[model samples]
Target: MATDGIEAVFLETHNWGKSARFFQALGFELDFATDHSSGRLRNGQGAYVFIAEVPEDHKPGMQVVLTVPDAEAFRPGPDVEVVTPFEDTHFGTRQATVRDPDGRLWNLQAPAGN
Candidate 1:
């Protein structure tokens, strides 16, 4: 099946509180925060943003995720590079990685199982 389109954004930051506040000031509300200084924020009915803290040495980056009703049923076109096959994520979802023609990586996520 085809993808459902942009779902969420995975943002990495060295300072979780500051990053969260930045989004909050933009009208996003906290959905939940993990004990390890990570959280998800939502604004209205749009895509949610997940902010996670990483080590200072790690370069912070943002990733856009596309949602599929079922990972097992999703099949990408030839132009897309399958970096990693669908796998289970620690957050209780099935996820896969694919690359665009420009070499940027993107995520495909689906709920647990069929």
Candidate 2:
């Protein structure tokens, strides 16, 4: 269900810096960072997603983020499930999280300053 283009993808990790730097070394720019709950990393092109550490007791590696436009306007289509509601990020953008029937995660974000 790609609308415009690939926006952002998140990699959950216990170490945000390592992961963030890894992506940065690969040419991704750091747009913003947050430690409100879990740490987050955004790329230069406006693709900022998350990479959080899984709780020791919780299952690991079962989330994905699908980037979309106007996260607030995106409605649940078919098997989609809204996990996180659209809200302003500390980095100053509107973002939301959702899940597919398979439990795969998706993230929707509007353009910067939108």
Q: Give the top-scoring candidate (lDDT).
A: 1
Pairs clashing in candidate 2?
A: 11-51, 12-51, 12-52, 13-51, 42-48, 64-105, 66-106, 66-107
Where is model 1 poorest over a 10-residue stretch in terms of lDDT? 71-80
Give per-residue CA lDDT, model 2, range 1-114, as digits (tens): 344555655565655667677777877665556653345555555655666665557654634445566554556676667788777887677777777678766767765454
Q: Could you tell me the TM-score of candidate 1?
A: 0.95
Tens digits of per-residue lDDT for model 1, 43-89: 99989999999999999999999988988778788888999989998
Off by over 4 Å in 1: none
On the 0 to 100 scale, the lDDT of residue 14 in model 2 is 55
After TM-score superposition, the amount by which residue 13's alpha carbon in candidate 1 deviates from its true location, in angstroms, is: 0.5
lDDT of each: 0.93, 0.62
Best by TM-score: 1
- Give the clash count for model 1: 0
Alpha carbon lDDT of residue 54, candidate 1?
A: 98
